[model samples]
Target: MTPHISRKTRVTGAALAAAGLLAAGITVGTAGASTTQTSAKSAMPIKLSASHRAELLRDASTTKAQTAKELGLGSQEQLVVKDVIKDADGTTHTRYERTFGGLPVLGGDLVVHTAKGGAIKSTTKASKHSIKVASTTAKIAPTAAAKSAQGTATKTLSAKGADAQTPKKVVWAASGKPVLAYDTIVKGVQKDGTPSRMHVITDANTGKKLFQYDEIHTGKGESQYSGSVELGTKKDGGKFTLTDDGRGGHKTTNLENSENGEGKPFSDDDDAWGTGKPDDPQTAAVDAAYGAGVTWDYYKTVHGREGIKGDGKGASSRVHYGDSYVNAFWDDSCFCMTYGDGEGNKKPLTALDVAAHEMSHGVTAATANLEYSGESGGLNEATSDIFGTSAEFFAKSEKDPGDYLIGEKIDINGDGSPLRYMDKPSKDGQSQDNWDSNTGGLDPHYSSGVANHFFYLLSEGSGPKEIGGVKYDSPTADGSKVEGIGRDKAEKIWFKALTEYMTSTTDYKGAREATVKAATDLYKAGSPEVKGVEAAWAGVAVK
Candidate 1:
């Protein structure tokens, strides 16, 4: 005779998330299996219907009883054994059991039963754990070539005291393949008698010297530069791009070997090349490096964080995502920032502000862990934009000036205008500087101004302020006058607040309180620092 008893324990998505975080799964029946059994005891296989599996996967709050009920199983039916089993007919059976004597239910366990004739007579638990399959991402970096004695294989160039070396570093590339790398930095002079510099090309693989070069200006006295280095692999193509601010203003340059075949323009559907001409791989490298370096420093210096996670590790940013995608985003799955070339006047979305904005998303994930949906969601988006702008200012990059505009250089509109206007929210058709129920309810990108304006007002008070030849006046609610806190302090306060006090549903008012609390914690309630938090919120009309 078979002893058949059903048992079940509820597992919610939150529980799963917690479990996953606390202890990763074990390797089960086969590698790459999604379902893993937990707990050990000789028990009957707790059979759950197909609907139960679907419900558990879809609903984060589902309980085992609810799942069982949905699957037409009795409430008392305990899930003693759950296994993804294949019968002789190749049909998958989800074996579950409800036992009168319940087995110990722990994570990563399987139930085994002895089948006497046609019924289960005895049951035992499998102590082995089942592991979850981790997704593998593809590595999409340009191939590196070997360094030769004369000039190319990836080798380091040694710098001598008070003297210069010939080829800083060189790598040979096949004639037809694409070569990609940035030019080495060189010293130069500005028209205004200021000193300028362009970073010498460093080997991407080994961080060694590849070549030396100088930045020059072109087209209406824009600071520019031209140079080349052996990036090593034609398999990825070769091109060098540079952003020079050493002189006075920003200069963007793209250099490619004329001999390398001309590449195609950007397209949206294409996943591999992203958007942009393949002509210059160096420019791509330059943009990627510059963005990563600036963001890495912003997190390190301002927040005292070692890196994104305070681990001193650098993340990758693919210059091109889709063809002419015209937007940049950070995907958690890939753990990377991807940019696209714009359709028209919008340049590539590789500006310092854009890069910082994308990178800040990673920081937000590491800290506040805010969900990207409602009021907290809007604050999250604004946090990125605000930090992005702050980073640009922090860098004082000659190529891209720090400003209130978000996609100024990209020229997305085909006109010389930016995508978002921070000072006067009304400049953009949708963005709102003032906070109200309606404003909070709008899209995060648009609703972002509540905090964005808050950041600007806090950094540079309400009223008129001109930067980099751009002019605007920020207004305040309650008409209380306040002074600018400057970006450095503002960033610190906001970061502290986000990582420490804010939650998923925190609103603009909540943000204000958090910042104030953060300020008090960092400086003091009556300190000048707290004054800025108060003033910043007042300027944004958050009250």
Candidate 2:
């Protein structure tokens, strides 16, 4: 009964300014590139147009049954469309999740790629084996499975009051052969003040624990506001509430030192909010709202993503969570972002990059649904860091300019050092700069250094360079020099791979293949961009 217990990992980011300003219209250069050239290139839309998107959705929605049958899946299996992506060449990629006999099939997600004529070109599946179980009946009772899960959570996570939810029968196909299992969720609070939602999978016949993973993803950051920023507020009678109708009606609330339930909505007599000081309660709300808005804009403008779930619906932001709680997290159950005040409630973890980092977690959940364990977990964390840094750069904040350093302004370590360095991940002493056999054995936060290093080298190339007044000297695993194809291209490639190709079980090697395929799709085969991606992955010893 040795269940894999996934722990909560930390993420960090820098401050942001000009919350209302949209980066979509602005053209910014990367590293030493010319601003004019960069702006023109950035202005060109890389995502599907409105009509094309509608068409792709329609096609995907209508073809799920036929596609599933064509794929030779079991008769009891059914496909549910999750996302659709259309390329400029009229190629379409549709992502789907699988279910067997009405039971959710874990790790059964797949992507179907179709040519311009609607012919299936290829498919990427999380699990290669067929999904069929001997019987749906569970030899072990659901109550017993729940109790075992709760006990496992209590023993491994030090969870307090760990109550188990009703167990659900699911097809456990993430690893090994497909089997009927009981999926139990244990809810409680961890010893570190982090909310716990541990998912435990137990084999039905053997009553043996298969795996367990925590739902809470924790991270740290600092908030620094230089001047006033515009916030999206809605007028209700006389007072204005912290709701942004412009961007999916996203709202910000105050937890007021409480660790449970949704907090009260922030309201003001006048639209004017925040004093740019942490002493005022409204100040933290302002920072949080601003960060959420910027993150929303970053995805909407840069990635053509409507919202966190890409349904044009907004996720709420909760600030001032717990007393002196120095971390922030994203909960998919609530579909909201939660922030905490640093030690003594002095520093709020509502920086722009942190907001982006946490929200990106939601995006990953809605797309790749990456399992938060092993190498897949490392890729999950790195995806957030990559997008967090990209959003930070997109904001073009002069106060805390974009750099390769993560959480540089937060000072979470009580020292002036940043939480992690993307250029050379090993600088943190705990992170790996290159991939190895044991990379997956490290904590996801530390193992994430491999992909972070790959992204940095891909964006800025290997060797020493200066960007936004910050000096970075990135090195390759093979000590070979690699040239960059710029951050804009790198971001697009990663985004495409995540939404269209990668799956729950994808690891470093799969990530390398996904990125290369994404690059080849965006840029023609054998293009410089494709070569750059291959070289970058090799730089991280992924090859």
Candidate 3:
């Protein structure tokens, strides 16, 4: 008779599916019926994935293997081994051993098991414990097809049994929440899952459903930035609507197809997009929510600012804009945030720092209003960069780490280098660290160095130092000695000065004066804090 072993014990914890347990060298015998458990003729060879093997061995909380071996499997044939985990890009497949009691068996009626995270459940009675199969299906829904037809094609849907479009009228429910002319249009159930349609109310001539494209699924597919803002046109007195509905949920009644096709300005906050497409609307909503929350809180709590204009309201952050546009930007006119996906290594620029940088532009415009050229322009640009970097470090996220570099996480440059470096602005082919009349001729990115260097010196002080894993050794124009103030304190001083002292035409000297005023106000004029500010500017060679 073939020797059999029973390896069983109370293996408690989260259930884990015993995946792919195909072994080499041994075959199962015919179904053996008897009081005693079946055993391996020699030794049953079991193969397991490396990751699963490691987890089994590391699970010190249980004595499953030992208990199983003790039941029946003799030391000779009882094999308790480990495997090497391969590249775990995103999926996990593991293998585990199953025994009747605590012994190794050639073949026995054991149950298969499956669990999530950790913990085991009852095993399946299948003959095979694990089997190799094709890779898992994509976790995200399919992409939506973009509308390519040039002109707008009007197709009237049969309103039979369908909810007729509601006209613009103010309606209030018992709850006091104004149900303003809300109408729901059923597009039918989504192919992947869930129900979708249009819900909007506007004037008959307003042109709702003007532009409808396949709504991109949130989160999983490539990053798409579809942000809309209605800014005051030369004719409309700058009245613009800033709606960042990246998920394609906003539905309006009247929209015109402009020459730019999808580029037509979104008229209202609720605009319908992604012509009937299956997408993870939930994921997209969460992403947008978190992004806006982080950006808003960063500005308000950290800087004591109200909103984008310090008005206590919130700015818009659109997500899942297009198919795969891997980038984000802040439009000056629209004053909205846009995000895109990565082209190769480049990722969407939706991080906290980027949002802060963009928002700060509004702050600068309201206060210093530094021109986008010359020394003043460089100051304007660097102000955004410095504040952006500060805002990034301000946020502490395990998902995304804060660094002194801009666009580092986004990978805008396929080489993995950051978009810009404040510690050493000269690393880029064009940024300038010192003030030069000729510096104004360079692009804003390069010309931004003078102010970038100034802020660096003001915040960290000149000389060899390390703040957040980044190394720095800033120089000074005249071998003058300067002391550095910690970043936390310095940020406060600059923000205060920017909002309180500086004006639209504030220049390099004006920044110096404004900052000095801020420092003296925060710390007594002759206090150590004041001295540090002076020294920092001195180190940067700022007179």
Give the winner by lDDT.
Answer: 2
- Cα lDDT tens digits, model 1, 1-543, are 333212111211100000000111111234322221111111112223345434533332233344344444333234432323222212222223232112211111222222323233322221122221121111222222112211321111222111112222222111111122323333333332222233344334444444332221110000012222111111112221222122111122221211111122222121121123334443454444455666666666656554554434455555443344445556444455555544431344555566678778777765554545457667888888877777767665443456777766555566867778777666777788778878756767788878888887777777876756678788876676667755665777787677555643467877888798666655545656577788778776677
Per-model RMSD to reference? 26.4, 7.7, 29.5
- Worst window of 10 by summed lDDT in candidate 2: 5-14
Per-residue lDDT tens digits for candidate 3, residues 96-206, read 333222322212222212233333333211122221112222222211111111111113222222232322222211111212222223342233221123223221222
Clashing residue pairs, backbone N/CA/C < 3 A, model 2: 11-219
* Ranking of predictions according to TM-score: 2, 1, 3
Best by TM-score: 2
Per-candidate local distance difference test: 0.46, 0.82, 0.42
For model 3, what is the error of residue 471's alpha carbon versus the real structure, in angstroms, after optimal superposition? 2.7
lDDT of 3 at 77: 28
lDDT of 2: 0.82
Position 436, candidate 1: lDDT:
81
Which of the two candidates, 1 or 3, achieves a greater TM-score against the reference?
A: 1
Span of 10 residues, lowest total lDDT, candidate 3: 14-23
Q: Native-vs-model 3 lDDT?
A: 0.42
